[model samples]
Target: MNEFKKTNIENPVVVIGGGASGMIAAWRAASLGVPTLLIEKNKKLGIKILISGGGKCNITHDGNIEDLLKSFQKNEALFLKPSVYKFNNRSILKLLEERGVETYTRDDGKIFPKSNDASDVIAALEWYLRNAGVEIRTDCSVQEIIFENNCVTGVKLNNEIIYSSNVILATGGVSYPQTGTTGDGFRFIEKTGHTIVPLRPALAPIKLSNKFPYGWGGVAIRDAELICLVNNRKTHSERGDFLFTHEGISGPTVLELSKYAAMELANNKVELILDTQPDKDATMLDSEIQQLIGLHPNKQIGNIAGLFLPNRLVNHFLNSINIDPEKECRKLIKEERKQLVKLIKEMFIGTIDTIDITKGEVSAGGISLKEVDPKTMQSRLVKGLYFCGEVLDIAGRIGGYNLQAAYSTGFTAGESAAINYKSQSTTP
Candidate 1:
């Protein structure tokens, strides 16, 4: 049991994980004049941040904090209310701005660095931690957290024991194993009397059971509704733009609804129904198609359909319903026209095969929020222990909400822990 001497403080505040939340937590703790140490198993910090938003890093969402809270579920929003309000999107942006990183918000309210580089975000965070005198230990994996009598003492590594009264576990969930987030925090906390919500994949792509032979990999559908139907009844649905992958489909809408769809896929048969023309009903679309057919009687039916649907999907759409794409509009019968209308309104994509959690942008499920104090992000079951970021069972939809959660929760935990440490140190 060797004591680590990386910091001058008698008992430094130790933070595990070097991702978004961990970095912020260490910075905040050290900023309060508390010596802090950030430990990461990987060779570098913010590996996950570098790959987020396709390397652009959607830093946070812009708008009112209340509106931003609406992006998460009711319980999650309630749990995050205090922390998020304390360190909201504006708070995070101000920190980054002070660190020499300029950012801009998209029309849809997703904020990103002006450089359009994720490395800039990481660099700013690193600069903040360094200037604040936070000691970071990379390439060091925490084997276990040492606690006795329901109080956290510190963490145990391969050959060293770092002693600290306060330990913040900001380790992320089980997603993108390549980034080093392999559910280690879940394991560490579970052994310490924390209840973990079963982990699942969030913001992941869904693989389709129906394999379309055609290469529709790059084809995109705009303003379409993707509905998850179990036994022919609608269970969940979302509306936005989605792109066709070689094996399946992925986009904002699909990624947002993936959490629900993945849950429904366990027992029931799940099918994805795409409403390509959601704005118009079958009757309205049929009338428009009839008018087009009447005006161009000599034109091929497939060519006419191209005006309504993507040209690349026209032939497949016609063939799936047993309609001849080359048939002239004048020769089309009433039944065939109705079939075209039905297919146009609700195109059957296919049943869901599986949603791989490893490919998810964020993993759902973690340490139960009920076991943690929302006001301080301290564990209710264990003294001197704290949690933040994806380690909590709160996951928001795509578009900067999750990142904002990380920053807010981390700040709350760090501030609270540092204050608690100060009070304890001065106690008689």
Candidate 2:
């Protein structure tokens, strides 16, 4: 183990961000009796945390590491399993409860503060760090990183060079900029002689062209599948609710597929086919339609369409097939009515664009997972330098998975950094 010769600095570990991962890193390090310091550019830490999950703060998801890994995509999920196994959801829940943050898991396995208040979660983490003797510097910004011989030496903040033998960069991804994640960490990465993957938004809301009803703004399509099609071919699908923004669909389905959505739309155009009935086949829907047509032979087809969908959606589907609402069901052309039923079951909408990468919940592409050790969360390229949280290429689907990744990776990094520090201290 290489020892970074300690300066006269009081604290041994300096964590660069006080957000979810950084706070956990500092707390874990300090709990091990390592002198620790945490820095935050915001006037307060956990602003983003407090606002996450609409202020409920999905702290972590339930289930073991294997289950957690499936929540992520590509190599990001696979790389996180070992660290997650080392410090998974159970450990985090225990730590939070010990700090007075009571938590409960929802039916879907999302864990949150018992009060359902994100503030309580933040308070618990903050309290834990405080009790562990972790120093905090709020409203402070890091201007640059100081390094020598490929190892981090210290950081320059506000033009003042404060030195630390061991530094942990836990600054979060550039999403929710108002919360102070301004992609400042990327600048630090560029200065540190590390390669940054082309950063794009992950876990963010995608913008759509077709205007949706504001009444459906809060309507969630649980069990509803969102299938993305490029050139009329299905590219990806995720079954979850898509929350309607004044602009487009967001929430689980949109965020989960944002990476794919961004890629498929890169060539410019794509389609979002919302299968409200992914399970029921076209024949099943057709059977239901035939039965309804039989019962309403003299009634307007549009009036009975509501049995399967919203009233407005019914009319929209009928209109698409040039089926007149005033026309009786018996007068409807068989093929046209069948097409309306098909459109109802498989609603297609052209997508306008994806959310900005800077607005992603956590960035997807970072210093690439291949360059880092999953067991240690340490960069394979650097000797003693380690990484954690969103700064790495690892990102997960929403519902507390990403934050769990952050906490788990941060814990592993903290443990590894501390143990390595000890080995270095005892060496010669």
What CA RMSD would you report for each candidate? 2.3, 3.7
Which stretches of model 1 miss by more than 4 angstroms?
A: 1-10, 294-298
What would the per-residue lDDT of candidate 1 be over residues 1-428, giving only the tens digit for each residue?
56654432446689999999999999999999999999999999999999988999999999998999999999999999999989999998999999889999899999999999999999999999999999999999998888899999888888777888899998898889989998888888776778898888889988887876558987888998888899999988899997888767888888987899888888989988888888998899999999999999999999998977789989988998998899999999999999988887778888889998888989998999999999999999889999999989998988999999999999999999999999998899
Provide the lowest-lDDT 10-residue window in model 2. Answer: 1-10
Candidate models: Cα lDDT each: 0.90, 0.78
Q: What's the TM for model 1?
A: 0.94
True lDDT of residue 123, candidate 1: 93
TM-score for candidate 2: 0.91
> Which stretches in model 2 have alpha-carbon errors above 4 Å?
1-11, 191-193, 213-222, 243-246
Give the best candidate by lDDT: 1
CA shift at 398, candidate 1, in angstroms?
A: 1.0
